[model samples]
Every structure is written in C-alpha cells, then in structure tokens.
Target: MADIQALRGVRFNRRVAGPVGPLLAPPYDVAAEFTDGGEFGIRNIEASDLGAGSGNHALAARRYQAWLKNDVIRADPKPAIYIHRHRFLLQGVPVERTGIIARVRLADWSERVVLPHERTTTGPREERLHRLRAVEANLSPLYLLFRDPTGEIRDLMAAVDANPELDDHDQMGGAHRLTAASHVTIHDRLASLVAERTLFVADGHHRYEAALIHRDECRNTRTADRDSPSEFVLALLAAVEDPGVIVRPTHRLVTGGAANTPDAIMRMLRRWFDLRPADVTTLAVDTDLVGRVVLPRRLGTWDIFAQRGRPHLELLPLDRGPAWLSLGVTAIEGAVNRVFSADSEEVAQHLFPVVEEANAVRDVEAGRAAAAFLLPAPTLDRLLAVAEEGDLLPPKSTWFDPKAPAGLVISDLRL
Candidate 1:
C-alpha cells in the first residue's frame, strides 16, 4: 500500500516575485543550457543554494541561499498534496496529464511499495545529497505511476481539477500552459483512495535514492529520539491512467570512437545477430514507441534498429541467453561494454547515451561518441514486468515526457 499525505508546500510569492518563470525550473537532472540567457534558462533554479563547491554543486547551493534570503521562495501555510495538471502537446497532439504532488513515506527497496525502474549513478546521488544538505527541501518531485483498480482515484482527480484552488499559467514554449494545484487537506476525504495504490517511479530515481541516504543520515545524527519531518520524502503521484503523462524515448548517443556508416555498423552488428536492411528512404521509424526503440545510424540512409529481445522484436527467439539478459537494451549495453572496453569511469566521461535521436547522430558525427545507439521506448508494461521480476532496465532507457516542473509546490524539510 502507498502512503500519500498532503503537507504545506514551499512556494514563491507571485505578487512579490516578478514572474513565475524566473522561479519555475526544470527538474535538476533535466538537460538544459544553463548558460543560455532566457526565461527557461537554468538560472531559475540556480537561485537555490546548491552547495559549497565549484561546478553544479556549488552553483546550486549558492543560488539556493540567494532565493531563501531574498524571499524569492516561501513555504505554504499548511501541509497539503498539490493536485498538479500539465497541458501540453507532442507531435502536435494535445494531452493533459494529472497527478498529486505530495510527500510519500520514505521506504527502502525492501518495502516494495515505491518502485524504481532504472539504476542510479553514484555521481548524481552525491550531487543530490549536497543539494539536500544545503536546501533541506525537496528541489523536485519524483514521477510515480500507480495502478488505480477501483477508479476511485480518477474520480477524485476529476473533482479536484474541476475546482482547483490555485491555477498557475506559464508561456511554455510560446503557447500558454496552465498548471493547477490544490491542497490535499481540502480533499482529505479521499485519503483512502490515494493510499490504495502502488506507485511505480517514472522519474526521479535519484531523488528517491537521495531520500534514503538523507533518512539514514538523520537517524545517525539525532542527539535525542525525535520525529523529524525528513522521515517522508516529497513526491507527486499520478494514477497510471492520467492523460497528461506521456512516455517518450530518450534516444541514445554513442561516445568514444568514430562516426561509422550504416554499412560499417551493420558489419559490426552482424558479428552478434542477423541484419535487416530497412529502406532508409521510406520506412522511417517512429521515434515515439514507448519501449520498442529503434536505432537509426544515419549514414546517408536511415537504418531501422530491432533488438533481439522483446516478444515482438525477437525474430529468432534464441534459447541461449538468460531470459533477463535478452532485453534489447541490455544486449546493446553488453555490446558497447565489450566494444569500448568501457570501465565505469570512462562510461561517465565520454560514452554517454543521450535521449534525442538527432542529438545522438550529431554527437557521433561531430566526433563526440564513436557510435549512436537509438532505442525504442520501453512500454509501461515492460517496466512493471522488469520490476516484478526483481530486475532493472538499462539506465536512460525510458524518458517520461511532460516532467513536472519544480518549485510549484516545494516540500519543506524542517516541517
């Protein structure tokens, strides 16, 4: 069972603050040009004290202090879970995603209530820990997916959306986008409905991981037995069926070597599996398939990628490899591991996988990575299957779109 509770959120005083855009920021891990001078630039969140060192850590600490002291950000009057709605378009298709922003009980992996899909890297965890120490607040919301069997949660979400107490509007990429937040206390009658579901994390694996570390640190530092608010980490819960959420593929960018042509890539790939030449001219791959990602090495022609793992993609369905080992992403990772003789350190430095197809190809062509491996997006079903099997998908395998913006309803750690 999931524990969902509304707490007073920290927010900026809109009247005192110039504009929400200056305070609103993308999630900490999101890739955006910070140096760029624009409203959506990374400076918004930089106002938060990130930490006391150089690089992102120091920058984030100093900014956090500035925001707090300048009254750029403030805490809400009471505890509450915010019902958040993001209206956006993908490929010109309009979608409205809804979820509740709240503080969930901090549970270890053993509890099996809050689940994570990807593995977290140590570097990000350390960076997050630094930020947590500096701000003592949840800088972002974890994306959680829930299975609402009774449809009770859906009804509650609908009721909340209809009569939201706070409606925040922003000019997200030109068009006006609206985000509505309401107190969970105002809708306290639905607590039972919120607690009945299990949440699968769609994003913020590092945040959840950071919570575990923070909780441990608190337990060790207590001079006396006391109930500290850090017991619960902040999160945003959306029933899986929420319309505003969309899962998009985070295209892979290969690093470390040369920009190989389609034929060269095929020749190299043939050592492991059979080859299928996709007519790059007409059979352009759809980049948005949730789990079944495609790798298109644009060597004057686009090559369609099909990994030999999934039920649909496993054309041969060989009986040789371990069942879990046969996932397409895993296969690709294995191949890269062998080809580059990649160690963990090198993997972090040069051979990074990106989530955009064009960016991946460009990076390789521009001599950043040796080759780009584009993948199909994993379906939500596949993610759940992997978790139930006590396994994790390859890192950066899935990209949850319409990620919740930070600073809408900040969680106060001291409370």
Candidate 2:
C-alpha cells in the first residue's frame, strides 16, 4: 500500500526572486542549457553556473532562505494537498492539466509499491541529495501518474480548478511567457479517491530515490521525534491520460563507434533484423516512426542525418520476447552494447530525439553523424508494464513535457 498526504508547502517569495522566469530552470536530470554562466530559461528555475548544485543550487537555497526569512515564500498555515493547475501548449494545441501536488510517504522499493521507469546515475543523485540537504526542501516536484479511469479524479481536480484559492502567472521566459498555474487545496471530498490509486513515477525517479536515502541518513543523525521532512517525498499525482502531458521521442547519436555505416549495421543486424528501404523520408515529422536500428562497427566515421538537418535515428525492435528483446529499448541496448561498446550512460549522453527527421536526414547526407537512429514514442502503458514486470528501460527513454515548474511550490525537509 502507498501513503499520500497533504503537506504544508513553501511558495516563492515574489520580492526577492522578482519575476519567476529568471529563477526557473528545467529539472536537473534533463539536459538543461543555461544562459552564459549561470541561468536557464526552463520552468525549473535556478541561478548560478552549476545547475543542480553548482553555486546555482546554493543560490536557489539562499533565495529560498531569504523568502522564508522575509516572508517572501511563506508556508501554508495548514497541512493540505494543493490542486495544481498547469495550462500550456502541446504541439500547438492549448491544454490544461490538473493534479494534486502533495507529499507522498516514502515507500520502500523492495515493497514494489512505487516503481521507477528509468535508471539514475550516481553523480546526479549525489548532487541532488546534497542540494536537498542544503536547502532542506524540494525545489522541483516529481511527476507521478495513477490509474484514474473513472472521471472521479478529474472531477475532483475540476472542482478545485473551479474555485482556485491561489492563482499566479509563472512568467518564466522573457515577455513574461511561461506556463500559468493555479494551486488549490484538496479538501475532504477527493482524499479517498486519491488514496486508492497506485502511483507511477512519471518523472523524478532520482529525486524520489534520493529522498529514501536522505531519510535513512537523517534517521541516523537526528534525535528521536525529529519529524524530518525527508519522511515525505514531494510529488504530483495525475491521471495516466492528461491533456497537458506529452511524451517525446529520444534520438540517438552514434559517434566514435564501430556501428557507423548502414551496410555494416545492416549486416550485423541481419541475425534478427530484416532491412528494407525505410522510404520514410519524413521520419522526423512522423513522431511514430518505428524501425530496427543498426550501424556498422565503424559508426563514427560517417554522417547520419534525420529530417535532412542533423543525423536522426529511430530504433524499432525486430524480435519479441516476454523475457527480453520484446521491447525496442531492450533490442537497442543489446545492439549497442554487443555490436558497439556503447553502454546505457553512453546512449543517454549521445542520443537526441529527432526533432525534424527530414532536416536531420539532410545533415546525414551532408556528412554529420555516420548514421542516426530514430525511434517511436514510448507509451505510458509500455512504461508501466515494463516496470511492473520488474524491468528497467534504457535511460532517456521518454521525455515528458510541460515539466512541473520550479519555484511554484517548495517542500522543505526541515523539521
């Protein structure tokens, strides 16, 4: 069983942070590009050269402190689950997503109550653990999805949105353009429905794991009855299908590897894969391109392009299995590791989801990457199924968009 609770959150003190845009940054795990030395345009705002911890995390902590000290970002007087409303554009279509943002009691992974789809690296986990301890609060909210087929959860969210208690403009980027949010407290009516659903880790797997580790560390260091905030992990629980949610494909870049040429890749893949003229020139445009990916041992020597711009590659599985090779992620990982020396981390670092397939293909034709691999989007069902079966997907498998904005709400770990 999982335990979810309403928590007293610390909101951004508008005085010190000024406009939210400058303060917002994307989640640390995601590839975030900052301006100059220290500032990013993403909603998970942070300042400083080092993103997660750098002086940036520290700066975020300081700003959090200033807000607390001056009552800039104040804690809710009562413990309550906030009805978080995020309105944004997805694929040029305007959409709104609502979820109850709350502190979920940490569940031991051994218990199999909460599952993580993607794997985490040690370096980033350590960095987040340190920042969390320093700030003693959650700067970004983790994304969680639960099976809410009945409209009950949606109705609950809609009711909260009907009469939101707190409404604010995120105004993250310049021109004050950013996702708009509305935060409402979850009253007694929806508590039962929320407690019944099993939560899936849509994002923030690393942060949640850090929470467990931090909690154990705190238990050892603190006195009895310390009531450490690490006891609860900050999360947003939403339905599996939310209008504001979007999962984008992750493209893989093959450089400096044996799998460079198409023939070399095709020959190696012939054991299980059947090659055909993918004739799909517009691979990048169709976010649904699914095909087996193969490259020669010398993948580094040539250029691979997608959409005619940069080398874009998508991987589809040639084989199926209940134990392995059934999923595209599995096949791709095996091919990379067995055929080339690329590991999971290497795949994560090198892959970029095909943004424009045609443009990317042009780049390949012009000699950019030796070859590019494009893949189909990973569905929410596939992710949950993979985790439920006690398996993990390749890193950077799915990119969930409209990421929970930073600075909107903060969960402090302090007593």
Candidate 3:
C-alpha cells in the first residue's frame, strides 16, 4: 500500500527570505537558470552549485545549517502534508494543476505500489546518493501521478486549497499556493485515497532510487527505535484527472551536422521513416505543427527540423515496427538511436535535450547543433500504458511542467 504521510517540512520563513519565489529553486534536474542574489535571486540554496541540488553535499548541509541558524528556514512544529496548487499558462491557455507534497514511504518498483515510467542512468543516481548521505534532507519533492477515479482526493485537495498557508508567485507568472493539511481526519482520508493503488513516478527517478539506496544502507548500519525518515522521500502527488496536469515535450538537439550533413542523416532516417518535405520557413509560424503533431498518424509521421533544409514530415509503416514501438516518443528515440551512429547506438553522444522548441530551433538554425528533433508531449494514456507494460520510453522523455519547485518545502530526513 502507498503510505503518503505528513512530515515536519523545513521551509524558508517569508519574514526572513522576503519572498518564497526568489527562494524557490526549479527541481534540481530541470533548473534552467541560477539567480545569484537580487530581486530575482535565491539566497543559499546553491542551486547551480550542484547540478541536481547538491554539488558539494557537505557544503549543502553547511548551507542548510547556516540558514537554520539565521532564521531563514524553520522546521514545521507539527507533521503535515502540503496541499499544492500551481497555476500556469501553456500554449496560451491558463491551467491550474493541484497536488500534495507529502512523505511517501519508499516502495520498491517491483511492489507495484509505486511505479516508474522511464529508465534512469547510473551516474546521476550515484551523485544523488552521495548528496543524500552528506545532507540528510530532500531538497525537492518527487513528482508522482496517481489515479483518483471518484475524485475524492481531488476534492480533499480543493477543500484545503481554500485556505493556503503560503502563496509563492514565481517569475514565470506561475503561482504556487501551499496549505498544510494536518487535521487528523483529512490526513486519514488522503492516506486512504492514495493507499493500495499504483502511483507513478512522473519525475525524480534518480532521487527515488537514491532514497532506496540510502534506506538499504541505513537498514544494515543503523539502529533506531522507530522507522527512520530515510524510509520515505518527499513527493508531490497529482491526480491523473486534474485539469492542471500538463506534460511538455523535451526537444532533442543533435550536434555535428556539419560533418554529417542533414541529407546524410535523412538518408539513414529513411530506412525507418517515410520522409517528405514540410513547408515552413519558420518553426514559430506553425508551432502547432511540431507542438501538436504525434508520429504514426497513419504510419511513421513526425515533423523534423535539421540543418539548411525546409524540414520533413516523416511517416513509418504501421506494420513495420513492433506494437510497442508505435509510441511517438519510442519511435523518435529509436530512429535517432538508429540514424545518428556508427554502431546504430550512442544517441546521447549527439543529443542535447531542450524544454523549448524555440531554443531547439535556434540551436539548429544558428549552427550550434547538427539538427533538432522537436517532439509533442506524450499523452497521459501513452504514459500509463507504457508504465503498465513495464517499459521505459527513453531518458528525458517527459518534461512535466511547470517543473516542481525546490526549497518550497524541504523534508528533514532526521524526522
């Protein structure tokens, strides 16, 4: 069963930090920019210091201690789950995504209580483990998506949203409102709603695995009267039915087009996709073409942008590839993996992931990268089906937006 418990969250005090927005760091994995110290800057989180929130784990802990000493952050006197609401605009439409930040007990992926959508690399997991060992805190919460068929949990979150304890407005025009749902009755209801069902890890694959590693290491080395907080990781769980749940695409930018011309790449790509020229001088003119289009419309169709050409709309035969390979993300990854290498692998060597298509296009058009493969965000149905089948799409497959903010509510592992 899924145990989504409340915890003594360590958070920055508004009185000391001025605004939570400035203090908030984008989830360690998806940080776009680092603010040093200004009207827009963060204080001591050292976001850029470590790629994934803790570059120097000891230094990170020291920063935490210093902040605590200076009254910048204080631990909640009582245990509570944070009801969170993020309001954002995507594709020129307003949306409000609601979720809860709570301490979810570590459940192995094999247990089916908690699930992982994508596979993870080893190096990132190792780095996260080192950081967790040095600083006994969760810098950010993992993003999890669960099914609430009857809307009970969604209603509970809505009731709590009426009176938020903290309202943080970020520079991106998104508002993050947090409320502590500590009442015993409400907590029990939420626990019941989220219990015994599979909750998918939308993000934070590395952190979750790192937590498992820490728990295993602790179980062997430590002695404690009660279960340790290391047994759980900070997580924000959103209902699959929530209106605010938006998944954005992570466009892939490949390097070295100069050496391997677009014609050459396209030639290799034709083995899998039926490539045809797409008419558009600019990527922005028909943003939806790239933003809305999903491949295998009839066959293997994907709009692609590469060096010095109009671009191509690709289609693959429905009967040609495996049924699982029909997924747009999977097909694209497979094509890239096949097309861009000598051994028909090593896509990572040529690939750079991007959150924005403009940036992806700029990098390609400006000669910064060999080509850019823009993608549409995978549908909720696609993600669930893939996870249910116990298959991973690819690394950097989904960019769940707005990326969960860090430092909004820190989970103290000691608790």
Q: What TM-score goes with each of the models?
A: 0.81, 0.78, 0.85
* lDDT per residue (tens digit) for residues 280-367 in model 2: 4333333223343423344322221223321112232333324323444555555555455555566555444454445445555565
Residue 93 lDDT in model 1? 81
1 or 3, greater by TM-score: 3
Could you tell me the TM-score of candidate 2? 0.78
The regions of model 2 sitting more than 4 angstroms off are 15-23, 30-59, 165-189, 224-227, 258-263, 281-325, 341-368
What would you estimate as the lDDT of candidate 3? 0.70
User: Per-residue lDDT tens digits of candidate 1, residues 1-415?
Assistant: 6776777777766665655544455577653433332432334453333333355555565666676677766777666656676666777887777677877878788798887777778877777787777668786777888877677877776666666555555445312223344454455655666666667888888878988898889889964233466877877777776666677656555544543333444454655554455444222344322122233445333343443443333332244234334345666655445455565345445446676677766665675655566665555666766666667756666788767677667786876
Best by lDDT: 3
Model 2 whole-model lDDT (C-alpha atoms): 0.60
Worst 10 residues of 1 by lDDT: 287-296
lDDT of 3 by residue, 1-415 (tens): 8998889898878888778875676765545364543432332443435434434667667777788788888899988888988888877898989898999999788887787877788877887787778778888888999998898888888887788888777766788889987788888888888895789988899889999999888888988433589888999999888888778767777676454455555555555444445444333323223321222222222454322331222432243333234455555555565564433236666766788777776666666765667665667876887777676656777888776778788887877
Scored against the true structure, residue 382 in model 2 reaches a CA lDDT of 74
What is the lDDT for 100 in model 1? 76
lDDT of 3 at 415: 72
The order by descending TM-score is 3, 1, 2
